[model samples]
Target: MSAEQGTHTHHDDRATVARHAVAADAAALDQAQRTASPIAGRAAGAPSGLDAAYATQHALIARRTDRGERVVGVKLGFTSRAKAEQMGVADVILGTLTDAMGVDDHGRYDPRTAIHPRVEPEVAYLLGPGVEDELAEPDPSASIAAVAPALEVIDSRYRDFRFSLDDVVADNASAAAFAIGPWRRPADTGPMDNRAVSLEFDGRLVQAGSTAAILGDPGRAIAAARRLAGRHGFALRAGMILLAGAATAAVPLPATGVVGAEIAGLGRVSLRVGDGARTEAR
Candidate 1:
């Protein structure tokens, strides 16, 4: 074979290998989600590089969509330095959020199907139409329809809630469920930075921090989401909700109790925890 032709063939072979790896990783994660079983992190059928991991992520989300789950938006993870340290991952990651993953404000969060669940406080953004274009400009505030105090319930599919960066990315950033509070116009919420954020379980404060922990300001998470989405070839659409990552390290979700999150100016949002599996809260 000619030198250039040989190089082209080598690239094609690598692409084929990555494609098969992505498919295998996606299928393993889908099985784990369905059976509520924890697979060995990275040690099992996980793709190697970030690119393959993201491809696996999209494939995993495709499985959910095939089963009738609509993609509602995207979520940024590891935006908080502390959360990244806790997870042993330094880079930021994004995950797909589907309609089936949302819980109404004040609704019950049943964790029966989760392997090990945790809850964290967050700032959420409601995006308007043409968000993709607006986010490309110097200031993207115009594309933000509203902001809210939010909570995310993350349940890693890996055993013991352990995984490497690529493993978690392929597993869709451990997205299990989420809740958002009342929406307030962006103009009314100030800059959405420096707001006191806290998570309470059964009326007791368990985790506390500030919105500033979310990539300096929660609004910055929106920009980060846009960039990550573009990198993954995912489009940001109108009426989509953007979770800006946790303000504090997540705490174990209770078995049967009210789990709430509050942002100083944005008000509070909560979910009633349901113990469908009779597993005790950690």
Candidate 2:
């Protein structure tokens, strides 16, 4: 093929990929939503890398937004080097959080509506006005208004909870639901490193670890988000929450019970789970 023909073919291929990604992402999300079933993983047609994967994620989030799901914040995933290496991903990734995905501070979760629910503990960052402006780089400390204990609910659409990096990214990092505790200024959680994080399901310790498990310090995840979001032509914005990646491995959500997390300096946050439906605490 001639140079001009090759250029045209390349552009056409890009457009085709974009269209296919949109359709595939929408199908995956829609199926996951309707029946609470774990759909098949994207294999041969999955995006090639982080950029392409995020493009597909944006498409999926856009569909949610179109359906009136307001973007509430962002969540970081795989921030721990161990997790990244285990998952075979080169770096940490992000996912969009919608207001609809929020479980209030002490909300109740219904496992039946959630496909393969699992939870993780984390230190949440409340961004300030500084992030709204166009800065070359955001200072995690400067942008942080407060910190809190957070619990992230994750449910992968991929069958059997297995997926390639691109598949997980395209699934918006498996964001399902999240809750945050009372916020405290950074001073309250002084030097947030190695702080203990433990989760209990129905009064039994299900997962345990320290903040150090999350990329040494959860603050680094915020910094990474700040830098990364800017490259995508956006800002984190004030009033938006950022759930620094999970500090410990996720544990399956009990069929029906109260699940709680105790973060050494951040105090406790809990969610009650039912078999059929969910209720938010006012």
Q: What is the C-alpha lDDT of each candidate?
A: 0.85, 0.82
For candidate 2, the lDDT comes to 0.82
Q: Residue by residue across 1-282, what tens digits does model 1's lDDT show?
A: 899999999999888877777887898888998888998865353447888889899999998999999999889989988768877776789999999999998887878778899999988888876476843562558668889988999999999987888888989999999999999998887877798988887778898899999998888876787778878877798799999898998898888878888899789998888854232233
Per-residue accuracy of model 2 over 1-282 as CA lDDT, tens digit each: 999999999999988987786678666765685588887766356557677777777878888888899998998888878888898777778888999899887777777777888999988989987667665365677778999999999998878899888788788889999989889999877988889999987667888999998878888877778767865433478999999989889888878777888899678888888854344333
- Per-model TM-score on C-alpha atoms: 0.91, 0.90
Output the worst ten-in-a-row residue range by lDDT, candidate 2.
273-282
TM-score of 2: 0.90
- Model 1 has an lDDT value of 0.85
Off by over 4 Å in 2: 1-6, 43-46, 275-282
Instruction: Give the Å error, residue 10, model 2.
Output: 5.5
Window of ten residues with lowest summed lDDT in model 1:
273-282
In order of listing, the candidates' clash counts read 0, 0
